[model samples]
Target: MSHSRRSILGAALGLPAAVAVGTVATATPAAAAAVDATAWTNLELETGITPQPGATPQVRTVTILGTTFLQARGAITCNLAADTKIGTLPAAMTPPTWYVRATSPRNNSQGINACRFEVNTAGSVTIYGATSGNPITWVQFDSVQTIWR
Candidate 1:
């Protein structure tokens, strides 16, 4: 005799959906072994900051997943005006790996737009300018994807 899937399963297991979904935990040992070898410890932006600070700060935030994916972007301003105040990462990143960089200068100031930044494991980030470097104003942005298990 022929039987529908639901009829065969529901009659035999008393629940077609449960049986179809393999809800029978005792049916296999693999079901119980579905635990993650590397549990998802945490998740966050690579740069941490979505935007820096200034009259026209341009910044972006990125969310890094696992150990194989990243996305970063931002929008900033540059005009060789006052030291440009881009955005900053939040205080929640990897660590001991802090470094800063300067976007392309808007005008020709002989490296007047140089900058420095820091990133602690705990996610604390800070950005500073060189003694000779100042900010600008146009529209420049950056992103850094930092992730950890």
Candidate 2:
């Protein structure tokens, strides 16, 4: 089934819209105020994962209007050539009970070496798929964003 533009935008903004009419709806003040950013907190990497060269990993919780968001940035490297756990988030910034995926910076193999990461409700952040032949040693978060609440 196809979704109307109004419905897609409504769902993304956490608002209700008249999907049948197929018209765009103006965002409420509450929704417009969702751009506020909070201070960044230093994120400690899990054992076995270390920041690459000059990169410093960090996280922050921002309240966009009524919705809570978690943001992470910087880069890291893993000591093991396998799925690696990156770090943990604070309780207040813990995401909803789901796997939130983010893409790492592209590798030398013409971007085929990029890896996927998942952040769970337990605040554990992990990167998947690293092998001996094509080891995923470096990852840049690039201000990854996910819903926290």
Candidate 3:
């Protein structure tokens, strides 16, 4: 006997009737395993900020798919004339977790700027000056837990 397309698909899937069930199958251990957030608890930036004339900010690696998350704070630039702002990190950054920022110096005086970072995986990140206008100072403060999933 020959099976129709419906029968073939059903047989292949090992399901009952053609009536589609709204419920989806749960992911197996191999398919979806829980990520450990604690592994990235102590992740930190390896490099410091390097000021330049028009250099772009850097994105350091952090973590992903974990239960715990990390929050980091640091300083970027010391250019008093221009206003410095931190930029968002890359999407799905794994190994080299990092972030970037831009500096706008209003004057020549030195200015101290600060920033914070949060990671959801066990990873490391770095923050560096993006612009070449003036070399910005960097200072990492601390990493704290924000949420656990």
Candidate 4:
């Protein structure tokens, strides 16, 4: 009679337990190689925001384990009004309306500028956390987690 490992152990320990028994089959190697799954795609920025030198503002999206994540890094400059639309992400990668905080260099002059950003379902990106006297000099989004819906 074939017995499961759990059953054998339970019997050896003199304990009552439910055991699951199954056949052990040998595995076969795949005949073909797997394809590349690099799916990081770049997003475009709006006209108001300019990519800084060597720190160009960029946004990208990548889906892992059926969940899509939006990642924005680098530096950008926008002298527009508050809540100004900055850019649009891909429809598939865009999440529901979310307000996230980013860092700015000149806003506080000490690299602690926590600028609020709005990421909407339509893929619209906006900055609504700066005042007239504190226009965002450069915003960074490398540390924020933006999950798409």
lDDT by residue (tens digit), candidate 1, 25-132: 546776545432222222232332232344223223332222221123343333333332333343242333333333332323465543333333444433444233
lDDT of 4 by residue, 1-149 (tens): 32233554576466333332111133233412221223444446887688777775556655544444456766677685455777776545545554433433335643445776667656677766666655666676666445442
State which candidate, 2 or 3, has the greater lDDT. Answer: 2
Best candidate, TM-score: 2
For model 3, what is the alpha-carbon lDDT of residue 72? Answer: 36
Q: TM-score for every candidate vs. truth?
A: 0.29, 0.67, 0.25, 0.56
Number of colliding residue pairs in each model: 31, 0, 34, 0
Worst 10 residues of 4 by lDDT: 18-27
Every candidate's lDDT = 0.35, 0.67, 0.34, 0.56
Superior by TM-score: candidate 1 or candidate 3: 1
| Candidate 1 vs candidate 2, lDDT winner | 2
Model 3 TM-score (2 dp): 0.25
Model 2 Cα lDDT, one tens digit per residue, 71-105: 77878866446787778865555455666666666
Tell me model 3's lDDT, rounded to 2 decimals.
0.34
Question: What is the Cα-based lDDT of residue 124 in candidate 1?
Answer: 40
- Which residue pairs does candidate 4 place in steric collision? none
Query: Comparing candidate 3 with candidate 4, which one achieves the higher lDDT?
Result: 4
For model 3, what is the error of residue 48's alpha carbon versus the real structure, in angstroms, after optimal superposition?
A: 6.8
